[model samples]
Target chain A: MNIRTIITGLLLLTALICPALAAKELSGQEILDKSQKLNEADSRAASMEMKLIDKDGEVSKREVRFWSKGEDKRLIKFLSPADVKGVGFLILNADSDDEMMYLYLPAFKKIRRISGSAKSGSFMGSDFSYDEIGSTGYNDDYKAERLDDENGQFKLKLSRKDKSDAEYEQLIMWVSQEAFVPTRVEMYKEKKRSGKAYLELRKVMTAEKITKTGKYWMPFSITMEDVKKGHKTVLTMSNVKVDDDVPDDYFTQRYLQR
Target chain B: MKRDKPILCLCLLLSLGLILSLAAPTLAAASINGEIKLDERAYADGSSNQISWNRAEFKLKVASELSGQAAGYAELKLRTADGPDVSSLADLASKSKVSAYSLELREAYIDIFGFPLSNLDIRAGKQRIAWGTADKLNPTDNLNPYDFTDFLDFGEKIPTNAMKLTGYFDNTTLTLASLPVFTPAAMPSTFDSSINGYINAYLPAGMTLVSSESQLTLPNATLGNSMYALKLARTIWGQDISISYFKGYDSVPNLSNLTLTAVSATQMASALTMTYPEIQVLGYDLAGSFNDIGYWLEVASFTPDQADQTVISPAGTTTTEVGQYTKYTVGWDYTFTYDIYVNQQWMHGFFDERGSTLSDFLITRIEKKVMDDDVLLALNWLAEYNNGVVGNMFGPKVSFYPADATEIELGGFNITGAAGSTLSTWANLDQVYLRFKYSF
Candidate 1:
């Protein structure tokens, strides 16, 4: 064959394959958006049991009922553990830049407003922080970039867009290629990783009892471990109902007292 | 007749409780839940030792849909506590041997939601209402009375027969309440006799102090004696703001109609009558947060019909007059870590007249949780320093939860003060207390 003819044929073959490879590759932002959409629901009611394990291997359990409407409104009521029963927490994300949070203690029979700066505090002495549970969407607060593709999974690095808004400066997420679910996440206090991930989420257990309701994929169980603190929190959800009719008044302080 | 009144009421409540329990199944949803607490205290001076089943309370709540778009809610609480002197009728009525226990109705309230208007809610019955931004010591909370017989039981507020109507706007709420029956604060009948003797020593010659008694006079249940209040609350600029106005009889009575009579040559009788007088109060409260600190401020101005005063004569005759005053409190709270929290507050009282004897107080509280929150340790301290006399109280407690449904708290309270200080009167009562609670 002639050299000119072979070169032309090789160029045509490369052009055909490049478009297909590009079609399969997705940006980090696209993966996160897909994952968030799968998790969001119109209304949700769930009974959850949280098991907190410390470094000494001692475990304390708390049972609570949680309800959420849209991305901004959420309510949590402790149902078990006599000392903390009937304690309620409400979070309302306003259309503006601020958020409102209140805590109701049955012992005092009063509802107290919690400060916004408490978002970085631990959530009920668990491994998760209040900001972690309060997070709804990452697209608005974080900028994501694709890091690597390995073992049928996509690795994404997310850094906070507004430095002051979040406690963690950056997060590394490992997402599944097939389901777009996040298999693991690593949190960091700095924007750049020096040698190894600072706070790695070593073990992640997804829900085996998820139910696909409408266009959403619901998970009923999740476990997160704080490697630096040697702490773990296992959250198991049950009796979950989605898209049910929820009264708007349930999000008010009056309902919190009730 | 007075001793039998509580027994008769107890019988009526028992019948009512039976009827309600029988009919609870027919309601849309009904729940019966409560807790039982047992307490014991050992005094440092060994003057008094108290061991009692502090509280046995049961609450019933029922909800049903009424006509149109209205919903009805009814809640009732039955409580029983051990009284002093088991042989006394009051004590027997509270803990009957035959019927196992006599029950007192603590709350019987009916709430109507989604009333005629979509944004209005109404509640009427015997209920406890609290309003303020400050923690624990709320100057704006005057609608309910408190029982101070057990100084350690600080969170309990006596329920009153009242009607409360709240109207909601876009982001604000307006509440109007009418309290029909007046309830006065309950205080211990007996105090330290040494303090009384000390006061008598300061009296003029030949005016010896024999004994003193305080009597409470409650306003009769009448239309003219009713109390009313109005409150407006809103969240503005990331702050919760509220203003309230109350026209009512003071819960704490003033010493009125003081009489001193000579019983013998070297002994005299002194009688002090406590009377509740009509008063008006204007209160304001604000709560917000900056960074990690949550802060609150509450202020109230009380205007009485007459100023309060005390006049002493060489002949042992004493007179008192009641007055206007202002009270304010500012507090802040912060959580240092996952399991550590701290709170501090300063309270000030200012009377319109000079030499009012009111002292400013500072309180601090620290709490820590360990063993994955299964164990909690707390320390609380209060110091009164503005006045000439310095009084202080320190409390340290540790609580453990062996199970989810039970808790035990071990604590000690130490109070100290100058001879004439307010806390010195109770210095003999300093004690270590243990509490056990079970919930269902």
Candidate 2:
């Protein structure tokens, strides 16, 4: 009576707790998991390139190099035009501090700081803003909601965290279930009638040759439509070398302006 | 100076003559250009308030060649800001619905090309004539002296809404433009009661006149009541220089009778002796950018003078001699990279012998971009040294683009100085701003 009765009691207790635990529901945790997967699929550096061929066939090509540390920070440098030979930028996304932006101008032989308010401005007269190229922290700007599951991916409805965070009141992203990579994004920023943009991911390729990290698929090419400007921009990434023992000094203003 | 309203009316009528000539069933090259911008600013003045909106502006330009030697271009702009009201000015002063839109006549002109004139082209209508070789303060680029107050406002441009005629020869250009018969600045007391006192306090009292302290609103103050002027610019030996002159009268609305009587009866009659001058300013600008070094200088003079007498309880009479002022600035910009620039400007305001030395203004800034065009950084130091208005500002700014060219910026302005007296210690005020802009 002692062994049999004890076993039955233990079994009854386990069965009772299982349903309760399942009912507790970890919806937030599920969302984070999906986000991590999406980020992993976009972790490669080589898949992103530096040429913008507009729909009008106007091509602006440059040599762009980028380096990302873990999942939160990255540094990208533009190499072109004799005057901007040494300009570089450093971006950091730490948990405790506001994002930092540093710029190096060769002409002044000094580094000047740009304010966060100027982030949305055109970067070097290009259609893209400096903020456009930096990491888009889900926590800093948007409240993402999982809308539905379709074709092996989760669709999200993103509302701006603050009215001023974006020109668009809402954004929609389609993220893959296996990769967590966003394949498409739609922007609605203006008075509901105009200022809409569509970004479609054309191709995504996983990291190759760099064997230490095998769980990442980076975007190889993307097309952006600026309906208002009557133009389209295409970005292609190539020759990406990650974690190749790059020196910290290379991201300084001196390197950018050189 | 009194406005030759009759002559102005005639000139405006004559301007129509050129429009009639545009009727000859012509095929011209027309272009439509526009920019849609969305801007958001987060103020750091303790309230942590924010202002954000999107503005879509469209400009249409039509240029056509007439006969065998003439061409003309016309431009029209339509703009509207959509979003919630967070603009500091709107919060502090005016309030308008999102539907508030405006039509701006940016450019309208007729040009005579070739002709019997060698190396000469003639243009007429509301035009822009920039003739300075300097950076920020083009003393010689006197065709237009910008109104900082207006230019600093959101979605506004600084040009007299009028008619102009320009003749070009070789590297030299001679331009004569109508001043749109307007006042340089509006009087503060003319604002409606809906405008807060603090908001009205910052309006500059330039050439505009004040009529009464009773009527808290002004209705008939605009460019419709003014006259015209002339502008000239020339380039010599690789250097550019410009000069301009203007004369216009500003009538002090509500100054008709009642307030004058009340003032004449008060013991402050001496203060009432304040003579508001019809302002006339002569501006000169010079600028030259050679290699990586560019320099510019500008000087302006406000004619006539101003003064006042006030009673200080225990100190008897305090003679506050606030006179006319001369504003000048010199600046330089050096391009060290294909996309980076270092621009610095130094300025000084010299008051007439009758004006207060306590009201002078100065500024300096350094700007640059970094991080593969994803990050931009800047360090700025600005100081204004004078009694009741001396302060220094210094801080860093950071700009980030999370996607392509779309931007978001955060900036802090660290300022310290006497809140009231020039002799007092500095009190620091920090401003934090967030901006997002899209241009296509």
Candidate 3:
């Protein structure tokens, strides 16, 4: 009586708990939020290279150093190329009404304030737009909806909350379930005429060489390509330090000049 | 004797900088970088169309950590150029053979970060103190004297001997600077022709100003003669807003005295008493980007204490007051699709313009980048409106980045205007230039 009764009770308990412990099938917003968290840090330091490929497939490279602090600040300074050395870009308070941005050109010996709308422009002549350079994820700026899962990835369609506020009207992202990171994104621009609106895919971004640093997941390599221009930017990150010590004022205009 | 004193003081400061740079402990953690550049040019208006400018320049920058909380930086420059007796003004009197090659200490300063307190920084020695948010043409930037020796290389300033103290608060910064040595603006050889008119304007009807031998009267280096500046800045609504005040002599030259002897009842012979005016400047500036446009505004109000030009003649003594003036600049920049960038500015007073009435200037630059940024095309236009006269200087340039650190640029300027305008003097100065630069 003891063996039979114990076995039956254990099987019943397992049946009740297994369903609750199984994968929850995360929603699109939850997946984006999770991927966004993988990129957050109190402070980070990184050395990177950006290779620009022209339509003729000629590649020119740039060496860069990037530092970020808190959730709202980032600084990227060029380290190579005789003409652009010591040039830096600083971004602060992203996605907020009080956001501020600046660019420092060594040749000009001046720091220029950048507008939020400048996000539409390419960064340093690269295919990556200023908005794409930002590590801020799609959670706040866009509304996400989950699509059918495929190839061990969760597909999501994210439409910007305010279409006029951003350069891209929508983005289709393919997020890896295991690493909770976006591996591919298709950026679409909206065209409206005669009371009709349509979305056009204008740019594509793909990430590779994904790795985990402590608790953070990061892509060591990323490529951004513009469809119409036939231009591409390959960004490879190295010497990454998460939660590093960055000064509080590191993202200010004063430090941009430095 | 007075001119020699300032040079001596600068040498002493430079020697101190050398000592600091060579200090064993600081040298242990030092980094050195340098660059060499060459430039050549020709003017279409020259009689023979000869080389208008040929220059080669070398710069070495050294940065060292003095300790955990302090650091030092030094930038030295060596240059060789073809000139009509430039590099030193002593040539005006001694007729010293042209100093085609020269060496200079551009900037040397020691920074004491978090010195005396947790939020304060102290920088002392020969240094550059940039105090405005506008582009290169900041009306509030008066600490360093203009380096107009090569007007073609605009927006350059000669670093002055100074000390600066900065205090950083959360979202705000306060700065105070004291510059002991007064440095006057340097002008190119072409300025010699204009000097006569400048001096004659302040003389009596009988006196006619004289030649290329005009010498400047510089204020001596002393604590009482020091230029002092204060600025307080903060970010409000994501834009930088600052108010500043400068107390010092104007870097722009003006007539202080004239030695004259009566040659006739109505005509007189004249000698130079060249000096700049003492003025106080109150400045305000704002810079930030709204939407897609980056914009800035800088305004400076000048109250000259020594604005009167007094001349004693056979007829009587005439003292004309130049009065006060204001300078302001408003600018904006934007980048469009396909890498087209445009910058435009409107200035009420040019850098050297003074007096109650001043000319207005409109400056614009447009650039396009193609071939993965390997090539850049730019057009620059500067137009001046003096009273009712209008003049424009427009040019186009092409810059090719052949390699990582190499750039070759070819450009030309076309000057056009109605006769009888300040800029019209340079109507014949149409020039074309080529530059080659490599950095490491």
Q: Estimate each model's TM-score.
A: 0.84, 0.46, 0.87
lDDT of 1 by residue, B82-132 (tens): 544365566566534323434445666777775768888888887777888
Give the number of the best model, judged by lDDT: 3
Write candidate 2's Cα lDDT for A1-258 as tens digits: 699999999999989877445423424335545565434423335434445544456556555566655545556666553224335665544221344444554222233333334455554445455665544345446677777556655667767776344535666766654444566666655342356654433222122221223445445555555545544455565665544555443343223432
Give lDDT tens digits, candidate 2, residues B86-161.
5565443433332444456666667665433543445566655443333334433333334332212311223444
Which residue pairs in candidate 1 have backbone atoms (N, alpha carbon, C) closer than 3 angstroms, thus clashing?
A: B307-B322, B307-B323, B308-B321, B308-B322, B308-B323, B309-B321
Question: Which whole-number lDDT from 0 to 100 does residue A129 have in model 3?
Answer: 76
**Docking quality tier of candidate 1?**
acceptable
TM-score of 1: 0.84
Candidate 3's TM-score reads: 0.87
Q: What is the DockQ of each candidate?
A: 0.42, 0.01, 0.48
What's the lDDT for residue A168 in model 2?
50
Model 3 lDDT tens row, A1-258: 799999999999988767434324677787788888866778888998999998988888888898888778889998776557778998888766667888887544467778665767777778887767756567778888899877868899998896347667899999877778799999998888798999988899999998998678888999999887888999999999988788877787666766
Residues A1-258, model 1: lDDT tens digits: 999999999999989878547535768888788778877778888898888887888887878888888888888888776557679998887322567789998556578988766666667767776666635467667788998676767788888886456656678887665556666777776422776555534333333444465566665667777776678888888888878867788888877866
- Return the candidate ranking by lDDT, descending: 3, 1, 2
**Which candidate should be chosen as best, given DockQ against the real structure?**
3
DockQ (model 3, Cα): 0.48
lDDT of 1: 0.72
